[model samples]
Target: MQTEYDVIIVGGGLAGLTLAGLLGHQGLECVVIEAGEKIDRVDSVPDDPRALAITHASRNILASFHAWQCLPQDRLACFRGMQVWDENGSGAIAFDSTELGRPTLGYIVEQAVLQTSLEQAVRSLSGISVLHNSRPCDIQWQDDHVSVILDKGENISAHLLVAADGVQSACRAMAGINYRVHDYRQRAVVCVTRTALPHGEIARQRFLTDGPLAFLPMYPDHQCGIVWSTRPAHAEALLKMTEREFNQALQAAFEHTLGEVKESERRSCFPLRRAEAEYYCRERFALIGDAAHSVHPLAGQGANLGLLDAASLAQLILEAGVKGRDIGGRRVLRSYERWRKGENRIVMMTMEGFKYVFENQSSPVPMLRNRALNFANSFIPLKHTIMRYAMGLSGDLPVAAK
Candidate 1:
């Protein structure tokens, strides 16, 4: 029997929804099976506090699917500058958008807002079907199609199955894809706070011996979202502190740069681990987003990378469809895997290196990092290259007409 759709996505988060919208825009018939009760919105924001540092490339991809404009402008904070410093009190490097001839390097957007926008875009698409509160209990691969059994005993099939189900992806596990995980022995503590001084459209990250502490600018003056990574033991102690104590520690860690700090939202912590699948594609399956690769949050490129993956995969399917080729063919899947795997591996390794170099307590390592930062700041070409990569402009981008 013929399947009802061309593809079945087993997650409704940003990656899944974004891909659904993109494919639907190209007139592809797809269905998204989300385990959650409903699509996440501002009110349904998860307790895990985090924000997205969206680059121009990601914004362009979203805009192509009409998802970018759907977001509230006021909720997005355009950061024109980014500063990285060594906590050893040696040196700091800053990148300004003006120097790169760009209005803004990127925007610091709340994860909830981004998810909400993608969800709405998916909801409005005629060719995309969304099944909420449905979990995949089992999966069977046949020669022509893959069958997914929901927890409710309903069976559905599709030509291809997309695993955007996040880092601990069930689809990836079911497909027997081995994962190599590197535990960083660090935990990321996220929260929101009010500052005495304005952030001035600038985001800052201070690399301490323990981990990296980043302040992402948000809407309204004197407001920013904080992601402070530290050893698991220290993170637990911090999480146990009272609101006043937590704010005091936070202010001190940031050198009181923003003056008095007040906690504006609940705090949350998540363990940091890096994971990459042995293979991004199998016979009739593919992995996207965290399911395929996850890296350190110090660079703030995790979500951006996932969005790029979705965009690239959608482009491959659309182009193949136009050329009268099977979208789920192993040849097409392999092409997508080849293009993204290397790029994702490089990012993971880069983040791992940064984590090691900056988090080392050895006095010599601090001096070395300080010297590297100073050199990077003084060299125009090197600075431009780093900025371009961070903006997602220079990389293995999808082969699609801009």
Candidate 2:
């Protein structure tokens, strides 16, 4: 859209759009390069099958930037409690928001709603531009600026370049960053389900031998967005079943915690993997969102982590700008990196640990984890700590999130 900008974000997904809006709001000229069509409020995109558990801190960040209002209020579901258990063990744990003197724990937001709304928010900003279907090629890093060659041969320059692309990020490869990847060897099968009983605004997860199965409350009280993670083979087999047969299997899987599953959509499945870059920043480039790190979906913290990354970087960049410092300088970029990497690493490691403990069937491990879960349930302070962590209310929150 322009030959130059203060910041050029390489993806227009949630992270990229949020950063663009925040930075643009702060008076920085920002541009987002996306490979897809220009999506905004006018786009007739249907509701996405996937929903994210947006922590309270993330909601604060969104509210700070005014993007929260762009989302449809009717489409949001707030969970006041959570129930988790091991299907093969006696360990069961429950958490309630009331313990923390809060009305709700967090919210399950439809992915498409937030993404489109964020894109629209960026578009509304005078200082931010969105270039859709204009793919960037021939990425080159310079000491003072990052140069991007468009497929049509138009060149653009920016003081900072951020890769907010998804897990399989082309920009990450272009920057020559190394990442550690672990395939959980599980596939997540997602679909909308309607049960005989209501979800009661409680998000539930059952640790199966294959993986964890989560039924997140949707906007409708009787329906849920189910993430059924299991081995790839099992996912495929489940996908092949008829709707009735599928509901039976689904009910059997969750042990009908919400009662008989009466209806379900055609299941969609994707492999689960945890990935993290060795370094988040290099020269004039930085990675955020799934491009920087992607964790197992068992915890639903992956997107929340990425959004925090965007907020942290945005705050740092704005602070640097006010000081007349080079936004892409190694020192500046490293500050953003240093601020985010440790917290992200902890989240990734925590997810991996959960994946390991829940996905394994080793007799002793289940009993131990179950005992721990039961013990945790019995301890009010421990449950509060876990709830705080899950709600993104713990740890070092960025300025925007705070």
Candidate 3:
């Protein structure tokens, strides 16, 4: 029951745990406080219908913490290519790993699998601890450190307090940080399905009139993870449909790209929104993962962005420690903010732009977008550039991500 550490991470999710592992391995003492049951034991992770798209860069960061290695090979699927097309018109674009001189474009993994592996990796590190079923009730900001008061009457002090909590981050609110959320007016219906035809290890996205539908390949050739973003009313209707009806609707929406889609797992839904904090850090406080920002699932970049935030912040903190400087100092934390804020904002805007262009059914706009897609597809240089950027292979990336 150590009361003090170099860093106290709020939220033992992927981002927080990843930070703990990175810092602990570099000789920094860290503790992760989570308001959930302890999940460090083997097979303790719960089931989740949500799937995450892990870019090559994100994989590198996880590999640095050795979490990627802990993942079961059978639970992971590599998508060697992606096919995107618009259902409104005859326009489509495709990206392949061969074009980028890579073996695979990225990976599709269950959210629970990723979190479990990351938590296990963090737990194995020497100077890191996880305190589950613990909630932070208050924060005492100091000149060089921060003290967190837990609901269970525990006081934990650290040089830095990083909020890796989810979208409604209580830590961010408690720290007086303001955030902006833009509701997409849609809900993403997620589930795992088995298709009549094999997925061919490729990911597919179709832009419908209302929103986008993505079929991400999962383990086993015929299985895929489905993210169908649509209006609330439509989403509710889909949820209420019979299994057979839902399968037919899904198959029709996807245009049978992989043949009939059978509901192989329970379905779930969540609202889609783009949220960002006004500032990334204040004094000894900082935000990471969904705590700082949440993007549309259209591009499947939320988890990847959060993982990058963790890596970037950890790198900066380790750099400050090596120089004998206060890792929680305003200067060090601001550096992390400056490094990721704009980059994340760009991605958010990109997602918004994609949403607007497709959702706009106005005359000429649809035709123009279709033309744009085709034009981009035929242009090798532009296509490669988009592939690199989307896959996170090109950017001012963190050391671990690179």
Which lDDT values do the candidates have, in the order given?
A: 0.87, 0.88, 0.91
Q: State every prediction's TM-score relative to the real structure.
A: 0.97, 0.97, 0.98
Candidate that would win on TM-score: 3
Candidate 3 per-residue lDDT, tens place, 1-402, comes to 899999999998888888898898788999999998876543666867887889989999999878899998988999999999998899999999998789899999999988888888888898998998998999999887899999999999999999999999999999899999988899999999999999998999999999999999999999999999999999999899888999999999998888887665788999998899999999999999999999999888999999899999999999998899999998888899999998898898888899999999999999999999999999999999899988998878999999
Q: Each candidate's root-mean-square deviation in Å?
A: 1.7, 1.3, 1.0
lDDT of 1: 0.87
Q: Which of 1 and 3 is the better model by lDDT?
A: 3
Candidate 1 lDDT over 1-402, as tens digits, reads 234789999998888888898999888889999987674565566665687789888888888878888888877888999999988967789999999899999988888778887888888888888888988999999888899988988888888899999999999999999988989899999988898889999999988778999999999768899999999999999899899998999989999878878665788898899989999999889999999988889989888888888988998888888898888888789999998898888888888888888877777887888899999999999999999988888887874313
**Better TM-score candidate (1, 2):** 2
Q: Count the backbone clashes (under 3 Å) in each candidate.
A: 0, 0, 0
* TM accuracy, model 2: 0.97
Displacement of residue 95 (Cα, Å) in model 1 is 0.4
